[model samples]
Target: MIAQVKLAFGIAAGFGLGALTVQALHAQAGPPAYVISEITVTDADAYNREYVPLANRALAESGQRRLASGGRTVALAGEPPASRIVVSVFENLEKARAAYSSPDYLAARAIGDRYGRLRIFAVEGLAQ
Candidate 1:
């Protein structure tokens, strides 16, 4: 009673399911540790070479750390003057503090603060 396509799909799915191992459910070696989400002032301008480069470098370093640590990611963005820069570095409190202490991040934070920082905060997150 099954159409050819339906029958073929059923057999394929059954075989696929049967072949799946526990490894499938545990694709990643472990859960992610943390994530950092950053939003800069909306009025940010790429023309500001000094600021732009610092931002670029910060994101680059954060990205590398993310990959090597096998946890979360750091994402950065620029908003308008009316908007504010928001950065959330998710991880163990100690690790997050350590990241902030890094010279590179410190420099970027200085630049970002000059732009805007209305109601910014860091909180705990269950990395996954």
Candidate 2:
């Protein structure tokens, strides 16, 4: 519950600021792009299977617009910093944060506790 709240806040605050930053820097051609890696650490494939579908449903429901190319990911194998499911996205920091709000993202996150310690991080200043 606590982690979910933090994730929600992170998305709202991070993206709100990121959007503002983009607007402030509108002089640039476009929003500074980032390669977002929505990842989770897990040792069990069962966890991955369960989480991915739920998270996908949430993502489909939210409809948060992302300049991003693809979608979210679920942990496939191993453990944190080792095994992970990485999804790709191209959006400002604000959008990055917002993506977490996706039912897909949140659902996936919830199942995280079913496994070992799990987490998701947005890689700032990334590409591809």
TM-score of each: 0.39, 0.45
- Per-candidate local distance difference test: 0.51, 0.56
* Candidate 2 residue lDDT tens string, 1-128: 99999999999999999999987666453443343343344456766677656765655554433343224434467643334434444345566667676656766767866764544555555332
Local lDDT at 53 for model 1: 69
Q: Which ten residues in a row have the lowest lDDT in candidate 2?
A: 64-73
Pairs that collide, model 1: 41-79, 42-79, 42-80, 43-79, 43-80, 43-81
Residue-level lDDT for 46 in candidate 2? 66
- Model 1: residue 36 alpha-carbon error in angstroms: 6.6
What's the CA RMSD of model 2 in angstroms? 17.7
Find the number of clashing residue pairs for candidate 2.
7
